[model samples]
Target chain A: EAEVAQSPRYKITEKSQAVAFWCDPISGHATLYWYRQILGQGPELLVQFQDESVVDDSQLPKDRFSAERLKGVDSTLKIQPAELGDSAMYLCASSLPDSTGELFFGEGSRLTVL
Target chain B: AQSVTQLDSQVPVFEEAPVELRCNYSSSVSVYLFWYVQYPNQGLQLLLKYLSGSTLVKGINGFEAEFNKSQTSFHLRKPSVHISDTAEYFCAVSDPYQGGKLIFGQGTELSVKP
Candidate 1:
């Protein structure tokens, strides 16, 4: 099956360090999303992209986080000066534009900030 | 804007027993509802969705959900669960007004004991 791909499924870093996660969406998918899930909570959208262009990032903590999909197929999310509170699971998902609104997700990157 | 609420935080059930996970949503515009499952250290996977048509939607892993617009609820149910079914389940909402951005609930952990 065509699944969204994510890398570095697990990462541990100390505070004030930098961390990055990458995602490759399914082929032909036009919408891609990045979400964060606290240990006991559900996933929350951090950013969204439609064919290499950002569509929504209203909830992103912009001062510390930045995301981009330079080629419209794959994406990278970066966090500078990571804090302990940044420990969580980062999930990536992709879907077709104006479709049934179903999303296919990657295995996700689990980040732990010390 | 759309928001989802999973009333139960955790549900403990014995193997072969039926389970139900409750979810309620609030939205000003028309919306779509979804249920996703997350095994330990894994990304979220779609379980089922309710967009239109039949209110009862069946999904993978012997799971089903019923959408009740009057009650503003979409609850997930599994006739019988297995130990392998232990995981966190999330309920989400998406609407066109927000550019198809999905909002998720706090999640409900289903623990199936053998």
Candidate 2:
């Protein structure tokens, strides 16, 4: 029954502002992920972490977005100079190990940039 | 590379009616498939997954899916649905070689009318 935890269920900010979303994965999980869910579309991976090391981030917009799992447990995703198109639900998920193919997600933080 | 496709953008059904959500994928290597449900204002929840062995996998809330490797399809079906079942469903695929990075399809919204 352990669930991934996310903070600030809703966020609103102006363009060019900075915003951050936080997530705490289930205990013992080793892989963490950050995804963006635009309205009317499925979630897209922004970054992924294996423990404290970044595994994949090829799709991440590095110039504007950054994510880190400092302790290999909780993670934070930050976006600087937010754009209107950046408005979306930021979801965090975690799994026990790679290739499990089962993930537990947190109740995403919905961001709106004006 | 792996990609998923959800054929229906939306499916409307009355309460207690059976429903099926179509999902397909294209992959060059071995893959795993998963179905996730998202309630309004909430994060994604794993509905089911197909890793190996069984062609038919049963998941939470009485939902099931069959993995057709030949057809590259993994369709979700439920015997009966309720108003609470109204939400968005996403189909995703991951290549084993990619370390479980998921590629998702455009979601299918299931509107269970009362």
Candidate 3:
């Protein structure tokens, strides 16, 4: 089965440090998304990409977070000067352009800021 | 804009018992609904979805949900549950006008006791 892939399954860093998560969506998928799932809550969209272009990022905290799908196939999310509140599970998902909202997710990268 | 609400924060049930996880959505326009399951420390997995046509949608692991447009609800149900079913369930809505950006609910934790 073609699946979305994520790396650094677990990461722990002190506050004010830098952290990064990576994701590779399923081949041929035109839409990619990054979500954050805090403990005891559902995932929230942080950023979305459509063929290397950012479609939506209103929810993203641009002051500290940045994401890019350089090739439109794989993406990287970076957080500089991470805070304790930034600790969460970073999830990556993808779907075809016309999938109508069906998404396939990766195992996710869990981050913990001390 | 669209949002999802899961009425219960947690549901505890004995093994082999039937279970229902209530989900309600609010959207000014037609939207797609989905249910996703997340085991401990794992990424989300799609359970099912309601796009159009069928009011009742069957999904993996003997789970089903009914879309009540009049009530604006989509509740997930299972005839029998196992201890392995313990996990967090999330209800999400996606608006086509928003380029398929998904909005998730607060999540319901299902704890099936053995």
- Model 2 regions more than 4 Å off: none
The prediction achieving the highest DockQ against the true structure is: 3
**Model 1 per-residue lDDT tens digits across residues B33-107:** 899899988888889988889999999999999999999999999999999999999999988555567789999
In the predicted model 3, the residue pairs found to clash are none
| Collision count of model 1 | 0
Candidate 1, Cα interface RMSD: 1.3
Worst 10 residues of 3 chain B by lDDT: B94-103
Residue ranges of candidate 1 with Cα displaced over 4 Å: none
Candidate 2 lDDT, tens digit per residue, A16-101?
Answer: 99999999999999999999999999999999999999999988999999999888999999999899999999999998785567
Q: Calculate DockQ per candidate and list them.
A: 0.72, 0.80, 0.82
lDDT of 3 by residue, B1-114 (tens): 788999999999999999999999999999999999999988899999998998999999999999999999999999999998999999999987777778999999999998
lDDT (0-100) at residue A57 of candidate 2?
A: 92
Cα lDDT tens digits, model 2, B52-99, are 999999999999999998999999999999898999999999887777
TM-score of each: 0.97, 0.97, 0.98
Model 2 docking category = medium
lDDT score at residue A7, model 2, on the 0-100 scale: 89
Looking at model 1, give its docking quality level.
medium
